[model samples]
Target chain A: MSNTPNRNRQLRSKLGRVRGLGSSHEGVHHWWAQRMSAMALLPLSLWFIFSLISLTGSDYVAFQSWVSEFGNSVFLVLFLVSMFHHAQLGLQVVIEDYVHSELWKMGLLLIVKYGSVLFAASGIFAVLKISLAG
Target chain B: MAEDDRPLSPHLQVYRPQITSVLSITHRATGVFLSLAAVMLTYWLASAAYGPDSFARAQAALESWFGRLILFGFTFSLFFHMCNGIRHLGWDLGWGFDLVKLRMTGVLVIISAFGLTVLSWVMAYSHVGKL
Candidate 1:
């Protein structure tokens, strides 16, 4: 209705006035993801530390048997991928702030994002294969 | 774009050295190093998944002198970065901003990094029966 149109206009104008303000939606979510992933890693990393200590003298079969467990491998894969995502985002911020050249900054960020995702996926695929084969 | 007319910001090259400055730079450098290590970890995982032969090859490399050195450095870097990152997080939460507290935390981070690295390796080595 005509009244709805007026309300929409009012809202648009209000938002427009705030449009050029300092912050963007990007930074908040990125910061949160970094923090969340770091928090997640706290427990997982502790688990991994203990597991690695246990695996220290483990023969090949023993290590494989451990990783072959569905829950452990899945969680380990999750940890690795999330860690990569968080690390990539953190590194992107570092690069953008430190690298003076705009072109290089953009290029490096793209490389980091794609490279991290690729490596994470490949690692996960490898884990899946190893676990399934066992 | 004007060569001489544009305002320029100061940089590290203009500043004298200090321990804090050095540590700050090393923190970033080690972060970059950790990124590289993550890539290697992915490779190691992929190889382990491939087969026993692949895992053996990866293990052999890790057992070599060069690999051991890299692993040692990475362990130290990991501990240092973890400690320093916690220090930063504490500051972010508004807890250690005073100069004295900042300096004390910085020293504490270094010592803790060393202590943690030693403890981890001792545990790892003992488990492997190589201690």
Candidate 2:
């Protein structure tokens, strides 16, 4: 919804004045990306959970070798990136909705973006390091 | 519509509690939870990669009473979000837009989340002897 408190009537077109009442253009992209990641995560998350379950009673070597497999390692990175990116997008919206102050909103947005990226990078790095250790 | 007196949609307080509103809000809440849990997930992965000493510490934390409690919460949240997220993706494809189907799938997501939590813990318990 347009939170624009004041609109300049002089610049408003006929259609714009009558019907500009939905997401800003960027929202559609965010929505699309979130759904895209969600779809990807469906299968990836199932695999991750089941794979984790398989490793439950196993040891460090079992964990290492599981991730060391080529396909597993690649998907691990994909799953981490997609999950974090999707999370950042979702949290950004939550922050936007609740935090009305422009300064606080921007600050939270930066933290969510960078923090998710940092976590994703670390997860990916860990996966890669284990897989490559062999 | 005038900004001062715009006919906005009804606020949440106007509606009775229903699956639609409940699930919608729950979806957002679980998303926030999962995002925070990702940090813990990362710790598990990174510690595992760091080798035996680090992973042993990670394992100990995970098996501890407090850690298992957190893990239990995370596990349910993960499956719930996953199931509901798939339902959302279905909506994006223009499926399950009908009221009955939406309600059906929403109920299914909740049911499955519980079913999955029980199943996962059972599976974990079965591994106790194997450990």
- Each prediction's interface RMSD? 2.1, 2.3
B85 Cα displacement, candidate 1 (Å): 1.5
Worst 10 residues of 2 chain B by lDDT: B2-11
Individual DockQ of the candidates?
0.42, 0.52
Question: Which segments of model 1 are wrong by more than 4 Å?
Answer: A1-25, B1-10
Q: lDDT per residue, candidate 1, B1-131, as tens digits? A: 86445554447787897667767877878778878777877887787887778888888897799987887788788778777877777876899888888888889988998898788889999988898
Model 2 over residues B29-77: C-alpha lDDT tens digits? 9899999788888898999888989998999988899988988888899
Going through the candidates in the order shown, the clash numbers are 0, 0
Alpha-carbon runs more than 4 Å astray in model 2:
A1-23, B1-15
Choose the strongest candidate by lDDT. Answer: 2
> What TM-score, over all chains together, does every model reach?
0.84, 0.84
Score residue B85 of candidate 2 by CA lDDT: 84
Candidate 1 overall lDDT versus native? 0.78
Candidate 2 residue-wise lDDT, A1-112, digit = tens: 4667656434545665457433362325677798888888889888888877777877888888998999999999998998999899899988977776678989999999
Model 1: chain B TM-score vs. truth? Answer: 0.89
lDDT to native, each model: 0.78, 0.85
